[model samples]
Target: LLLSVPDSTTGTISVTGLNGASNPSFLGMFTTIAGFEPAGANFNNHYPMQDNVSDFHLYDIGEFFPIQPVADYNAETGIILPPNPNLSGQLKEYQIEFDGFEQVHVDVFGLVTSQNGPNIRTA
Candidate 1:
């Protein structure tokens, strides 16, 4: 079961299972703000990969988010992948679940800056 599910990519994010030593190995990365996953279940080489940002964190718990946020910026765009295109059809290749669509929601968070003056923030 995932806690957060984002509709688009977070540029770069860390992926790990909810608990235990096993984590959801980074499946794929979204380069654009809006996009979709090509038809398939083999996320082995399908997920996006990226070099960790300068001290920036990608995945928190199991959700994806940017390391930093700008004032007013929003990642509200979210798309939920449905289970199977239709009823009678069993979509095994896509891994569309029949029960709870466990997913990771994406969002932006604020950060305290080092600058003495005020800093901008967004989510």
Candidate 2:
């Protein structure tokens, strides 16, 4: 599996075999805030596990709608609080899993930029 994050909000994940590795039977991805961990965080999203007509098995995060928080209301004061803050600067965690492989290898590469000029990489 190879993961690439070109920007803060968009990414592409690709899974492929090495020389003669067989195709996996399943593929899943799970994502959550880094500091704010959630329950059952593994493999929450599943993708179709089949041979693509094209040469790549890829999933794009931009194709899905962003997750939104529910509204919070104060019963006593009759006021609604604002939604959560944006994801900027906050760390995020992504987990990828698959089946039908005796062994698996994973690699991640990313380039993040901010208003200040600096490049960052994480493992």
Model number with the top TM-score: 2
Global lDDT for candidate 2? 0.34
What overall lDDT goes with each candidate model? 0.30, 0.34
The sequence of per-residue lDDT tens digits that candidate 2 reaches over residues 4-123 is: 222123234334434444343333333322222224333332222112211122232221124455346589999976665542222223455544333333432232334535755322
Model 1 error, position 12 (Å) = 5.6
Across 24-121, the per-residue lDDT of candidate 1 in tens digits comes to: 33333433322222233222432222122111123223332332322232357554344432322211111112223234443322233244358643
| Deviating ranges (above 4 Å) for candidate 2 | 1-89, 112-123
C-alpha-based local distance difference test score of model 1: 0.30
Highest lDDT among the candidates is held by which one? 2
Model 1: CA > 4 A from native:
1-12, 33-36, 40-104, 107-123
